[model samples]
Target: MGDLSTTDRTRHRRLREQGRTGRQELFDVLGAGFVCHLGVIVDGAPMVVPTVYGFDSEHVYIHGSVASRSLTGEGRTVCVTVTHVDGLVLARSVFEHGVNYRSAVIYGVPRALEGEEKLEALRLLTEHTAPGQWEYARRPNRKELAATTILAISLEEASVKIRQGPPDDADDPHDVWAGVLPLSTTWQAPVTDPSAGHDVPDHVRRRAGTRIG
Candidate 1:
């Protein structure tokens, strides 16, 4: 079974209470983004590093260089967070102005993967980042796999918060206009590198209109 008890570190806040706390909301927020900020502790010092991650129903997988001292060292726990800002809620009142966004914060211990599980985890990571790119690209070799360090964190302790639509203001008779300015990120045409000797493939060209994921 998946872990449903968040460490409380991922709980919702009053200001963002319009936020959602369901599992689907959490998964959507996390799955919609590829980058995550990983917070770790080293020698009594705390460090937050930005990295890419992939998640399944049970675990969130992260990979970094095998030589990374932070990942290979002693500490077992880490905090991973992914966020997406959908729009800017511009209110007449400065205090009422806010942002429309979806965010997920995950807290758990990093567990190492080995053998076949490692390969599958890597596949999940790659496919999660880009839908069809994994099958089109080259797969990893044994030596490459050995050189990478992958850790899986159970999805037990996590939370999701989301804010959407317009800003709210008390019925002040003389307040200026207030509403939400929708914001969205879309993909542009893929430009091939100079080194490319032939026309771009269908998969690369098909990325146009692909929303940020």
Candidate 2:
């Protein structure tokens, strides 16, 4: 794929070395994570809300309660950020200590979805959160769907940044050790519901012992 088209706002002015211009890099950063911090203005104050998000090739979807103030407005500009910390970069000096991570920042005005589009967005959200849970579990009903709000933001304008490898304090001749302490997330054993007296579905079992993100 071609590099992502950059706008004035999306341009990487600082830390140009860490900025990634590939469209596939942006998609990979977003796809690997399940949660995002949504930055928006609410009631004349800046609010950053942490929530789950799902994405297709062109758009990212976020859902919340119908009464949520952040989701009430249409055509309002919002910033979404997703980040994954891969490791802690320990260095000889305190100032050189840093984190190795992959992150994506998206800027767009979101639009509310209705009818079938809304329902499909919900499915995408579900499947993204838990890959096979959507088909294994019960689908939402009419009343349940009525109480939820879904917003779709175009992924046309976004930026990706990634940092990796050992600490950059090679110039410092300190005896202190410097290395990367890697981190990862994995799915533990399934915890069955007490009320549901049935065997765990094969789809659910398949995710156990697997790494997430």
Cα lDDT for residue 14, candidate 2:
88
**Model 1 C-alpha lDDT per residue in residues 1-213, reported as the tens digit of each score:** 333464456555565566556777778888788989888876778888888889898889999552166667644778888989888998877877899888788888888889998999998998887667779878888899998778898888887777887777756455687888877788788787888777767876787888883
Per-residue lDDT value at 213 in model 2: 64
lDDT of 2 by residue, 16-130 (tens): 8899999899889988989999988888887888899999988989985522786577667889999999999999988899999999999998887899999999999889988
Best by TM-score, which number? 2
Instruction: Give lDDT for model 2.
Output: 0.87
Cα RMSDs of all predictions? 2.4, 1.6
Name the weakest run of 10 consecutive residues (lDDT summed) in model 2. 64-73
Clashes in each model (backbone N, CA, C under 3 Å)? 1, 0
TM-score of each: 0.89, 0.94
Which window of ten consecutive residues has the lowest lDDT sum in model 1? 1-10
Tell me how far candidate 2 lies from the true structure as C-alpha RMSD in angstroms.
1.6
